[model samples]
Target: MVPRPTSLLAWLLSTLAAIVLIGAGLPGPAAAAATTTGVKFVDIPGDGVTLKANVVAPAAAGSYPAVVFPSSWGLNDVEYIAQATSMAAAGYVVVSYTPRGWWASGGEIDTAGPADMADLSKVLDWTLANTPADPARLGTAGVSYGAGISLLGAAFDKRIRAVAMLSGWTDLNYSLYSDQTRHLQSAGLLGLAAQLVGHPSAELTTMLGDFTANRNIATVMEWAKVRSPATYLDRINANAPAVMIANAWGDTFFPPNQLADFYGKLTTPKRLELRPGDHAIAELTGILGLPNDVWTSVRGWFDRYLKSDANGTQPGKVYLKPDNAAAETWSSWGAQTTSTKRYGLGAIRWYDGTGLLGGSPTTGWSKSLPNDLDTVANGGVVLLTNGISAFTGLRPTIWLPFVDRNRAGVWAAERPSTALKVRGIPKVHLNLTGTAANGSLVAYLYDLDSLGNAALLTHAPATWLSGTAGSRTLDVSLSAVNYDVPAGHSLTLVVDTVDPLYYDANSAGTITVAGGSYLDLPVK
Candidate 1:
């Protein structure tokens, strides 16, 4: 159980001030306002540093609820003002500040560390002491790195009443190392750039060197072991409510499962909202706009908690937006609804003589010599005017290539009529036997539409079953998706020797894949 801030001494301080101010003939600010007026620049005192912040409040104000938006990436106070303004217009005082040393702030910007956390605490103290904000209603919200800071701050400070974390990571170690193993190619560079342009700290510089040399994974992992929030879950107070939003279709960085794991550990009254979108700041801004279902839910949550609206706030709100169903679509999981579905790899059958897999082998289809390990190359001839060729555009939509001793084989699945709707985790159960010493199997999930277009859903880790083995199941889970398999479209299951995005194949091995192997999909 987590301690409630309302029972803390700080809550008493705010309550006493409210009483004294009322007795002195001063009234609190009005709650209904179209725009915020008073804007003040303030300095927050930190350990050996000062943090700069922009405060927005109503003109006529003695006390009002406050929301804080922490700095993210390299964005400064000016860029955060628009988001702050919107919250301010909703009758809440808004404070957007540059975290640590990002811009015009003292001390170093260490992602989530003692210095950064202390600075955040100082910011809260300054806001409570200097602003007309009702200390009892303090809240924080942000996306990505900013969201990470807010979560960490709220974990330590009881004064923070509520929180909204968007696409944030609870374990940096898992996110940077385990989940995205090839970080040197992506997030590693971005982090290096941030250090070069912002902090210029020696530790950051050394870390950059380690990353560049490929020797930094160990050091980075050590750092993550110390700073990861997953290790500090018990420290998070459960009294304050939280809302976590994750993008199901995000590919830039951070896997959806990582977010799910974080959400599962939160003991607070929490709602997990998963959407389908890229890691675009615009999509987040759209969420803030409350233009549609996405934003509506978020605003409603804040209204109930921050404003203490009379309308009771419902719990356990889960929204899953399906892919390609509509221009913009979503599925809701509320108190009164329950739904579940499954998508799997259709069964495997013999390839007919005519390039079709059926009762007989396809004509002109010859199993070529063993290419690299665990793979076999097969060629087939089909009439150009055949319905199969016409419908498939003369190419296989689903390609499954396996890895064996020194060869690999490409296997393709037939297309479906309607677009397949994939909602949850899709697992591929492959039964393969190696002819050589040892080999590995890789599976890919994709969407093939009616227009002959193919897009990747998510990539899975390569599973090395056995080299001198009999038979084993290669299970790989694709990233969760709400994507629609279009009407007259087909879903694809590709098993290849390599995932170009993750790894390269060393030796293609000769392997036999049983046709009965099935794909188990969890759909909802």
Candidate 2:
């Protein structure tokens, strides 16, 4: 069973307290030159609130291209001090501010809702009026919450010319409720963080209440739609801001799949970079003014669009960096895949309780597994697992031999003669018959070595809760990834009922998997 809000909150607080040392020596706004010759912190009037902000302008500045950065969730104006200083030193007028109700800022937290969007416009207005900021060459950039607001600002405020949305979500609905399953850990962490460091509005409070209780979901999605940039894609395209999106493949809060979809629909000059990391991990070093690829590309993006520089990252390209491999670029998202192969799932062998995954299907068989129980195959703990993987170039691993077959259905393919460069999203098709009215499945794709050690490549979840029991056909697209399976390595698939990362809808029953299920692989 999923933990109640109180239990989740307690867990979150304890986890944060234990990991607080991770941030002990990190730079803060005090370490930044807030009162430097060309830098100053000030208070600006928001729509109906007061915003704490810092402005960094070129010391020998005429009017210059300006970039406004709204602080990330649970952060204040100093969140972007290093990035702002670097951008300012490079001849851009940069203003970074805390959004309403975060830290020293007044008003309740808007969660990047309408009021937050209004604050962004107000910050821009203040920038142009008070500093040597050129109104015509305006741009916005941020990470996480700031990134979402920046993207929405580009759609609502036409004066913005370019945007770099790092680790941002294009669709809020998908983030909170993907595959009709609540992302319990991610949502709980966000809600708890807001309550710890900021004031939550009534709307945000109610949204969390309905979200956790699994009630009024349609209304919650409606509210989310209004904040999603995907909902305003037409307006964004019409305004034509050069949009550059950089996200980690393992971003729990704002996954890369939605960013890829949003990037595909963009008619304006756009770039997408998918790397191996969790939410904001890929760009965290850049926040400390260290050398980072995402921030480098961010500066390059603004230079090209706002300053009309000739030497910037070329638009209309997608960059994918695989773990422990060289970065690869493509003309577009579609070009990431050359062809796809469908692997039919066969009957489970009685001796090992495992099935064969091959080119041809084997029907007339069924396998039953107890629901509401997790196996060795599960998505790792939300942030820490993926963040460690990003830095160490390793994924959460499992010994395939130890997997509990009674709790999960396992399938393995034959070893290929050559390496398989898996590039795009993997699709799973399954026919599930559940004894209970509600059930869920977490599907995992793994690369298994000769010794039976398996590394997670990608995974996704699907849930059925329409008060209908019996058979249901589920088509699930696993998270997009770029992984290479070495020659002589086999691909493994595992389907289990519960993962701690998501809310499990499964109850006390057995879910039977029918034969005719298959997995689709997109390989380059």
Candidate 3:
């Protein structure tokens, strides 16, 4: 059974003991939005130093359902107080806390280590002891770092009645380092955010060093495992808090695949809102006084479980918003699968390829352009343009710019007699012979119109180590997406040597794709 405070007088005394940390110069946790009248900063004595948190309770509250929000990496309570006040207005007590080693907090940052998870438990205990937090109706929520921590905390503490995770990763290894390749762009930006906010912890500094130097990841491999919630699925499943995941469809940082894997492993009550945007845009917009799915779905989740007032909102439903397709909903995850359609890869020319879709197996082959192996500026630039720049803001009020691939090694299928809807990730198989010590290849899927204009649907990257002319077969999984193929349009696969988002060998190599290679798309 979950635990609760039985004595009100003792809890009040603890609340009165709240203190301002000396030399830290931290301000009290007060709500910027005036929706909640009773807002105050409270300090809870923790393992090493005091953990700082802000409490926002209903004005005339006797006992109210409570929700706690942990800051995203390098952020403090200030980042989430706006949402806390909104919860307070809905008659819920909210505790927004800064994790250890962040601004105005104590102890070195552990980045979701045991110390960080322990900080969550401390906030829970303090909430129950000092506020009118409903012992039976408590839940936790956050985005990114805090989102993963909520799952980690729920795994150990059964008291979390419900959970809402936004743009979080289920597997740390896959999200941070996929196929032993680092996601340099996202990780570097996140590390920059950490540095801008506070001094770096030893662990974080080590990770940055290894990534920038392109060193083997063995130095910090074990640390990454412990932080991943996928490492503790058994514990999370046993606790079984009702889960609602609200994430973007185009979030390259924590793509839909990671969320899909975690969602599939659970048997608990659940809901999914797969919107369209990059990593932080949709989520931050919602947090900072804007209307979006993250806050809406989370509040409904808390209402259903913590308040026991669901108002007929259904769980287990999948909400999806495709880029060019109509919005759709699935009854449940089990009902959301699409049929696998195989399309053959055929050589349009010696250096270019076009998709031979809906046809039987062929005995033809396609070879990549040696020109791509050249470092000189050429058509390769068009194939490798990712459309993301350093100036892009974290809070996006619009969709990410579309990728442009005009001159590329493309395998494309012309408009079919019938229309189809792509409902999931696209898989690619490559039977190729290459001559290079080491190399990496990237595959991007696009939906093209009769005019040859196209929008990028999904993309994937792979690294290979070979010396002589050696043959290898690669099965690659592109990004997870939902797109509609209009009757007059076409589906395409663009192959290239490098991407701005990841590290590439940039060395010379000639690759010949054999006849058996194909692109398999999940369509309906």
Tens digits of per-residue lDDT for model 2, 56-110? 8877748899999987887766777777877777788899898998878999988
Per-residue lDDT of model 1, residues 54-116, tens digit only:
888766656788888776655544434544555666777888787776768777767667777
Q: Please give the range of 10 consecutive residues that has the lowest summed lDDT in model 3.
A: 375-384
Of the two candidates 1 and 2, the one with more favorable lDDT, higher being better, is 2
Pick by TM-score: which candidate is best? Answer: 2
Off by over 4 Å in 2: 4-36
Clashes of each: 52, 0, 3
Model 2, backbone clash pairs (residues 3+ apart or across chains), number: 0
Q: Rank all candidate structures by their TM-score, best first, as comma-separated numbers.
A: 2, 3, 1
Q: Total backbone clashes of model 1?
A: 52
Global lDDT of each candidate: 0.53, 0.86, 0.68
Off by over 4 Å in 3: 1-35, 350-358, 369-407, 435-437, 465-469
TM-score, candidate number 1 = 0.71
TM-score of 3: 0.84
**Model 3 error, position 240 (Å):** 1.2
